[model samples]
Target: MSREPMRRTIRGGRPYFFADPAIDKILNMVVVLGSEVWTLRERLAAFEAIQVRQGGLAAGEIDAFDFSPEQEAKLAAERKEFIDSLFRILQEQVEEARGRTARAPQKPAEPVAARKRAVPVRGKSSKTAKRRSRR
Candidate 1:
C-alpha cells in the first residue's frame, strides 16, 4: 500500500499554542515562501515558453540554460538574501499578528463616579444612602 505524505487536517497547526513565537514566525515564513515558489514556477514556465518561441531554442536547452557567473551569483545571492530576510522577519516576532503584542500596562482605571455621594455618618455611624447621579 502506498502511504500519503503527512497532511495538515486543520488549517495547518496553530502557532499560538507554543510558548516560543519563533516557531509561529518560521511556520508563517515557510507558508509565504511556498506560495512564492509556486508563483515563480508558473512564471518560469511562461519565460521558458517565450525563450523557446523567440530564441528558437529547444525546450530542454532553454530549461537548462546556462547563466553567466555574474548572473548566477546574483540569483544565488538574491535567493539567499530572500531566505535570510524571511528568517529575519521571523526573528522579529513582535510584529507578527499571532505573536503576543506587548500592550502598555493599562492605565489604572479612573475611580468611577458613584451615583450616590458619601454623606457624613449620622451620630458617628458609617452607613450612607444612595443618591441619583448628578448630570
Candidate 2:
C-alpha cells in the first residue's frame, strides 16, 4: 500500500506540499512566532485603549492618579523598558519583512505647514499714528 503526502491549502487556493522537514519546521516556527507577536501587540493596543478611555496623561496632574512617588518612578522605568523592547522587536520584524540584513531607520516626515514661518498681518504703523496724534 502507498500513502500520499500531506498538503496545505492557503487562502482556499491550490494545495502545496513541503518535502523538506527543516523547511516545514522553520515555516511552523515563523507562523507561531508571528501569531504570538500579533497577540502581544493586540493586548498592548487594548491596554492603550483603556488608557485613552481613562483620559490618558492629560487627565489631570500625575498625582491625581493612584501611585506614590517611588511607585510612579518604578512604573515609569518599567514602561520605558517595555517600550524599548517592543521597538526592538518591531524593528526586527520590519527588517525581516523588507528582506534587508540591516534595518533602515526612517526619518519622520515634517508637516508642510509646520515647516513654513508665520507671516505677520499688515497694520497701521505705530510711528505714523504717533506723528498724526502730535499734529
Candidate 3:
C-alpha cells in the first residue's frame, strides 16, 4: 500500500506536519490522548450497564465501578508506554532531520496542501437512477 509523504520544515527541512514542530507534536498527543480517553469512557459505560442490570451501587460508591487492580496497573503501563513511544518517534525523526540538514542545505518540497485535490462525490444510487431514466 502507498503512504503519504511527510511534510517538512521550510527552513531546515525537518519532517513535521505543521509549520512549528511543537504544534505538530501537541496535535498528535491530543489525538492519541483523545482516543485513549474515548476507549476508557467506553469501558466505563459497559461496566456501568452491567452494574445497572445487577442493581445500582451502594450509597457513596460512585467511584466503585471498574477494572481489577491488576487490569488497572496493566492499562496504566500500556498508556505510559504509548505516550513515551510517541515522543521517542518524534525525537528520532527530528534528530535524523537535523543530521541531514547539517550535511547540506535541502531544497523545499511541494506545498502540503497543493499535493492533494478534492475529488467529486459520486451518487451511490446511480444504477437505480439510470434504470428509471431509461424507462
Candidate 4:
C-alpha cells in the first residue's frame, strides 16, 4: 500500500517568514523557554524516581538507599532558576510579538470626502454600477 504525503494548511493567507530583529528575538526566547522546560521536567522526574526508590527501601526490600540532601538542594535551586528564566523568556516573547504586530503596516486611510463618495447612498443609482452590470 502507498500513502500520500501529508500537507499542512495555514488558516490565514500565505505564511510569513519573520527576519525582523524583534521576531528573531522572540524565536530565541522560545528556544530558551523550551530548553528550560525540558530540563526542569527531567529533573523533577528524576526526583520522583528517587523518592519511589527510597520508599521501597523503607519496606526492607532493598538493603540500602542513599539520597544526598545537598544534591536535592542543588536540583531545587536549578529548577527555580529554570522556572525564572522561562518566565523571563515568555515575557520577552510577549513583548516582542506585540512590538512586531504593532509595527505592521495599517491600511491607508481614505479622505473623508472620498469615503463618503465611495459608498452608494440609499435610493441612489450610480452610473458606474449600471455600466458594469451591462457588461
**TM per model?**
0.36, 0.31, 0.31, 0.30
* Model 3, CA-based lDDT: 0.69
Q: Answer with 1 or 2, whichever has the higher TM-score.
A: 1
Candidate 1: C-alpha lDDT? 0.64
Q: List, residue by residue over 29-130, the lDDT tens digit for candidate 4.
A: 899999999999999777667866778324332336444899889989999999988698577546644543566547465568975684555224333354
What lDDT score is found at residue 127 in candidate 3? 37
Off by over 4 Å in 2: 1-16, 57-135
- TM for candidate 4 is 0.30
Ranking by lDDT: 3, 4, 2, 1
Give, for candidate 4, the lowest lDDT window spanning 10 residues: 56-65
lDDT per model vs. reference: 0.64, 0.64, 0.69, 0.66
**Rank order (by TM-score, best first):** 1, 2, 3, 4
Off by over 4 Å in 4: 1-17, 56-135
lDDT minimum window of 10 residues, candidate 3: 115-124
1-135 in candidate 3: lDDT tens per residue? 789888664766647877788998898899999999999999987787777677875533556658889999999999999998879967754664564456546656445564333112223334335557999
Give model 1's TM-score versus the native structure.
0.36
